[model samples]
Target: MNNNNISIQDRSKLFAVRAIKAYTELNKRHFDDAGKVLAKQFLRASTSIGANLAEGEFAQSKADFISKYSIALKEASETRYWIDIMIRSEIISENKFSSMIDEINIIIRILISTIKKLKDK
Candidate 1:
């Protein structure tokens, strides 16, 4: 799918997939036990981003939609943090996490923009 035209739901789902792959790689003993813990946290936050976005799609009201999007933004932010920690700890290389980080940043921006638009309306 074209990145420019992709919906937030699709984009977040794609992000989740990437995060899962990262989790898989990290589980392969990329670091110490602490790395696994961080990986699990990272996976949870990353996947939640999409889950919340999907929930927003079926929102019962404008406030519900905004709420879901806000949750997604928070998840995206948490994902970004986990990935950065991984990078800093050398569990995941900077090169490896760059795209993943970039993707989360984009998702966060989109979620923030969407939520703001809904609130403004």
Candidate 2:
């Protein structure tokens, strides 16, 4: 992801890129039985964050837009949960995920803020 200021869509796409790359490494480095399940969940939730946001761009109505954003937020939360599980389960290292954790946190916060703003408007 670039350091410059960017829209949520662009940021999310960049995040997805990083996440896909990490998913490949996760599969290679931690392919144990439980690790497979965790990695799949992680990939689904992480990618859904962007996929939902992208879908929201073409929402048919304001309510639909909020719904899609809400879904993205939910997926973001799930992604965090999977990450925590992976760390606790020793499927991945904490230090190695610090940056992605930071990125996901920012994405989650942004999703929350956007949802609130849309609802208020």
How much does each candidate deviate from the true structure in C-alpha RMSD?
A: 1.4, 1.3
Residue lDDT tens for model 1, 50-97: 898889889999999899899999999999999888888888899978
Give per-model TM-scores. Answer: 0.94, 0.94
- Please name the candidate that would achieve the greatest lDDT relative to the true structure: 2
The runs of at least 3 residues in candidate 2 whose Cα sits more than 4 Å from the true structure, single-residue gaps closed, are: 1-4
* Candidate 2 per-residue C-alpha lDDT over 1-121 given as tens digits, one digit per residue, 9 for 90 to 100: 4464888888888887887898999877737788899998998898898899999999999999999999999998999999999999988899988888888888888989989999999
Whole-model Cα lDDT of every candidate shown, in order:
0.87, 0.88
Give residue 26's lDDT in candidate 1 (0 to 100).
Answer: 77
Q: Which whole-number lDDT from 0 to 100 does residue 106 have in model 2?
A: 88
Clashing pairs in 2: none
Each prediction's number of clashing residue pairs: 0, 0
